[model samples]
Each structure stands twice: as C-alpha cells, then as structure tokens.
Target: MPGKPVNTATKNERKLNFWERLYLPEVLKGLGWSIRKIWKEPSYTFQYPEEQWYPSDNYRGRPVLVQEEGKTRCVSCNLCARACPPMAISMESREIDGPKEREPVWFEIDMLRCIYCGFCEEVCPEEAIVMSKEYDLTFQDREEAIFGLDRLLVPKERLADRLAFLRKQQNPQFGSTWEYPRENNRHSLRDLTTDAESIQTEQ
Candidate 1:
C-alpha cells in the first residue's frame, strides 16, 4: 500500500560527498567565516542608551507638524490623513479669518497606530507634516501615545535639515511639480473667486 516515488530530482543533480552528507563541515565553515569577519572589523552593534546613533536626514522616524511664523503650516486639506496607511492621522478643520481660511481645530496622530511609513509626508501638499529624527518612543497608556498639536508642532527652523533633504531628493517623475510653495497653504477657492471677479471688473 506504499505510494509511488515522485521522481522530482533533475538528471544534472550531483550526489553529496561523505562530509557534505554529514552537514557538520558546512556549519563549521559558516561559523569560522562569521568569527573571522568579527575579529577583522570593529563592532557594528551600538551600546544602547550609552552610545546613541544619529540617523541621516533621509531616515523616516516619528512624524511631526511643521510650524512657521507662530502658525501651523497645515491648512487642514486632509490629504495626509487620506494617505496614511494605518489611518493614524486625524484632524478637524475650522474656518478662520486669516489668509489661510481653514486650519486644524485639533490635529492628532496616534503613535500606537502609526507605522512610520512616510506616506503622510509624501502626500502632504503644503509640506505641513514631515518625518523627524526622533526614534525612541515610550508610552505608559493609550492616551499618552496619541500625539496632539501640543506635542506634534515642531518649529520650521528645527526641521530645516529634513526640509532641505526632501527638496534635494524629490522624485524625478515629479520634476518641479511638487516644489513646496510657502503661500500654497494660504490659497483657497475664495482667492480664485476673487481673482476671477477682479479680472471681470477690469474687462
């Protein structure tokens, strides 16, 4: 009642020698290679808490809201929230009298749900949100992990390194299309309507 042989082996398959069949030689060879490399090179592992590693500007760490001129750069367009893979970003937009007519009444990013994928940063039209160099995060409770505007807003000056890096490393396909404009957040449908009315009056 035994099943027939599958015969899956190729004709070119080489038979293993006595040492190869045992597999001990191969394991020892791998160990020797690892030990040789370790002896020849400096230790690659960092002594955590004592030796801190500063990541490059290209590294995507915790996401933060960019603040400029005593105001949040975000116009509450909700593009970041929409692009977030884990739906970590949430905000409530409110009508305001400033040049930027719409602003986030309360912007929040749940660190517990955030994957730090940088999708939010890539889709932010106003460059209002960008990844920062902070890697260490610890929360005692669920509420502590939810980062609100008070914890998220970072001064533009402090984030200059990341901003410059982003500008320099823009996608080739985008060309100059994704260039950050400081006044873009100020632009709204009202401005377009006003411009149209002025043009009509002139005509």
Candidate 2:
C-alpha cells in the first residue's frame, strides 16, 4: 500500500490554464474564419431571374389544403378542427349539393394566433391539410393573415407538382387521386441559392 497510502491531489485537481480560461484565442479563430468566408465567396447568392431557394424536404410550415375540381380539401370529418392546439382553424363541413361527399363550407386559419405546431396536419385522415415549407409568408394586416377556405384551397395537381415524392410517401388509399408521376427531381432548399443579387444591387 505504499503508493495508495495517502492521496496528495485535491478533488479539484484538474484546472484550466491561462489560455484555456481566457478563451480569447478561440473567439479570434472563429471571427477570422467567418471573415475569410465573406472574402472567399464574392458572388454566391442567386440572381432572381436565374435561380431561387428550393423549399425544405420535410419542412412543416404554412398550412394548405388540396382542392380538386368542385371539391374542398376538408371532408367534414372535423378532425383538423378538433385537433387544433390554438383553435386557430375553423371549419364547417356541409353537404356539397349531395349529402354523400361532404366538404368544408367554411374554413379559416388565424395565422396570427396559429402556433404552427402541425397538429392539424397530423390529425387529418384525408391528408387534405398540410403545412407548406414556405415560411416567408407575410401579411399586411391581421385579417389578411387569417386564410379563408378560398385562399387555403390548393389544387391537387398543383400540390402534386410541388412535392413529387409526396404521393409515394403517403398512404395509397388515403392518397390524393390527383397525383401524377413523380417529377423525379427531389432537391433540398439548402442546396439552392437565394435571389441575393437583386438585394445586393443598388436600391
């Protein structure tokens, strides 16, 4: 027990040296790296006419519903309405000429109050409601942000075109029949360049 007879080191034996404690060098290194990037890439942003930022692959943002010919996306099930966290979504499903296929007579989403939790999209059985990847959505007034049935309604063909892999990933039975073949061109929004040339140019 010669070596273990006594413990000379204290509990706080490990301590940072002057350089480690200061951390000034690390901060300078990071600043230098960022400055180098700005200098390295002079013309990295897109020119509006030439390019644009692609939306995210699995982003859940703005709410939209697929509308077909003479049909609203909602099926009067009231799932989305019931599942809303902030109760921002309002829907009234009524008979669409025929009692068989019910559609939303009244639909409005209060974007100002909407928390964007994607709860409505998850609860939708018909997959009618979904959060779009577009997050730059702006509104001049609070009322304008409150999207109505007419504004929220998106043609199935348009949605299908926007999200090529959407059909393949969704349930076949619950899938929107308005689907066409995949565009076969799935790209991440991060990979695309934003239209910065216009902003960079003179006012």
Give the Cα error of residue 169 in candidate 2, in Å: 3.8
User: Candidate 2: how many backbone clashes?
Assistant: 0
Tell me model 2's lDDT, rounded to 2 decimals: 0.72
Q: Model 1: runs farther than 4 Å from truth?
A: 1-40, 171-203
Over 1-203, each residue of candidate 2 has an lDDT whose tens digit, in order, gives: 45664757788789878876689987898899999999887777777547766766567678888787857657777777777888898877777665447877788999887888888876676778877766767899988999998788887776664355554666565655545443322223432333334446645
- The alpha-carbon deviation from the true structure for residue 18 of candidate 2, after best TM-score superposition, in angstroms, is 17
Distance from true location, Cα of 57 in model 1, Å: 1.3
Candidate 1, 68-125: lDDT as tens digits: 9988999998989988989999999999997889999999999999999999998787
Query: Please, what is the TM-score per model?
Result: 0.67, 0.57
Q: So what's the TM-score on candidate 2?
A: 0.57
